[model samples]
Target: MADPMIALATGLSAVLLFLLMIGLTVYLLWKRRQDMRRDNQLISTNSVIPPCTPVLQTLQASSYGSAEVPFFLPPSFKSSTHSAMPEGREEEEQWKQHPHLHIQRGSLTIGSWFPLGSLRPDLYQLPEEPSEWAQPSGSTVRLCFAVQYQQEQEQLVVSLLQAANLPAQCQSSATLVKLQLLPSEDRHHRQAKAQSKGCQPQFNDTFVFQVSNNSVDQCTLRMSLYSVDRLKKHHLVGHVLLPLRQDELQEAAGKVLWRDLETDSDLPLSKHGNIQVSLNYNQSLQRLTVVVLRARGLQCPSNAGVSVQVSLQIHTQVVKTKCTPETRGSTPTFNEKLTFRLLPVQLDAACICLEVQQVGHEELAEVPSTRATAPVSLGLVVIGPFMYARGRELEHWNEMISKSQELVKQWHGLGAANNIYNNNQT
Candidate 1:
């Protein structure tokens, strides 16, 4: 009996040990899994993606010409002479000026055909020459230039023909012509030196601006002349304004027209307020996000149910979004996020249009009225790449592109719509 009891006790002990071993194995696995999960969490917490560097080569101001091929000197010479070259900021100022002047590879240089100081069209008198031409006197300065809108190519060609009777400057001062399109003075085009005999300088340089047909009527050409001395000090000589609304612009295609320059104090100011927005682009996912944060100092009429609308134009695709529930004041807080599926290639041509509209309470109703009513646009602001955007608008876009998946916020000044809607969008 004692021997049998001992054997039973040993068997029970062995069974208990086996159960203990199984429990230990299960506990070890659970601990190991917990450790692995903690490690994974630590790894994920530390991972960060750095902003991407812009890979596009920096082209000179004149280099941004769409079809005009510049004579690029050797790399060593270009780098050494770049600082001394007057066109250092041409990429930023006149990037949009030349996108239509196509020069064949073997074609003669621009200077060969258009000689300096050659007798061209008379800007002051069209179709007929004045019996005796007299120089413009007093503070008035005249700019002689030619403008043509090519409907087929959608290009606005501006030729700096010549300037006669310019305001006298110090003999050491060299004249430069700064060209920029209004209502948005985002980019400026300049010609370093004009062949001058006294106050008359001849500039046969042609600048081509890419513009859509819809916004052509509202476009205005501003030519600002400046005198830069040997010390690089700049003085405003005068500026000429050519409003596209005039009938002469439509009639005088490639014909020279003379305009009187205005003083610096006469420059116009933006009456429209400002809008706050945020932009983000995810290259890997091919997505774009726009956030309409708020608006301030809006110049809208006092009306009920005032709301803001934001439009995204990607090539021919246009998507619009608006803030719900009308706001009363000129300053409206939207904080709305708009997302778009954009391809990598389409980013270069994408444009954003924001409009302040006064919507009637009746239009906001769910009844869906049959009567068609157009929302009155109070103020408008458009932002995009260098093609149609400048200043803060272009800077915001560039920041968004360089830092993918990162949000870039900016305050853009508002301006009159001026039918800027015709800028190639659906």
Candidate 2:
């Protein structure tokens, strides 16, 4: 009995010791867990997160005050959820993910809330029906830009002159050349007898150029100003280079000749002035130049000897010029008439040129210009060759001639010549 009791006590003591050790370990673990939780809370509190969809929702929630919307939201604040992992952890995660996602923002200026995909309707509109049209916000273009020159501390209006002359047509057609100018101070505004210029304050510049667009194309114009003051003595101002297009030149060539076709059929050919055209063959001269004439009515001539004094003058330029000048400047211009003649159904390209300037002229020397001719059918070419010009109307030409015969003869002084060159100018 004594031995059993001793053993039981030992066992009970051992069991109690084990329970104490277990309890201490549990308490320590609980305290450690609490500390860890506190550390996590501290880290989360210091971290920041960008707003996402919720921000937009808040923005649209109501028409709140400007302060309600965080004005400094990063442009990349596209996330929809918030995360708090300490700033360091957050930065590490972001760096590991979107290294290229640049964080940008708009200015402090408060603008209207525009949806992401909103677009302007006027962006798409028919050219003829312009989205908007206004005859220059101002009537005068010259008033907008003025030159203020400094000369003896006094403002002087400067004048520019053409260093060299241009083609006759170009001269009259208001073309400008872009070149340096040695200022001419002698030029002063001629005093107006009447108050036509109006009582406007002097501006710094005399002319202003603006680019305008129309349905078909765009154009730039330089306008004169009423008054201007120069802050500096004649300064080397900007140059003016005119815009001359090859297509425009070709079109003008056609129209200039077309205008001369209005002569009365009954009128004597002698009454018309001779047409003079000087052609220049560039290095890449084409084998032929084509002149297409429409023949409606005319008396066909069977005889080939009929002479229609059409003169073609061509020239080889000493200095080559580009199709379009490098600079865009406008030149002064006037109007002049270009006279040329053509016989019905006759396709002729002449090589002719006149030496301009001094007496060392080169008009008499001309190389023949080549032409590609279309073979007319023998049947048509031979039919009543004398009755009318080839590929032209016989009855109409005769009528025109018959109708003007009286005036034609009156002008011709050959009593019977009136049968040819007489018609109403209108």
Best by lDDT: 1
TM-score of each: 0.32, 0.17
Cα lDDT for residue 59, model 2?
33
Writing each residue's lDDT as its tens digit, candidate 2 over 326-368 gives: 1111211111112333232321222211111111112222312
Instruction: Give lDDT per model, in order.
Output: 0.64, 0.26
Model 1 backbone overlap count = 5
Q: How badly does each model clash, as a count of residue pairs?
A: 5, 49
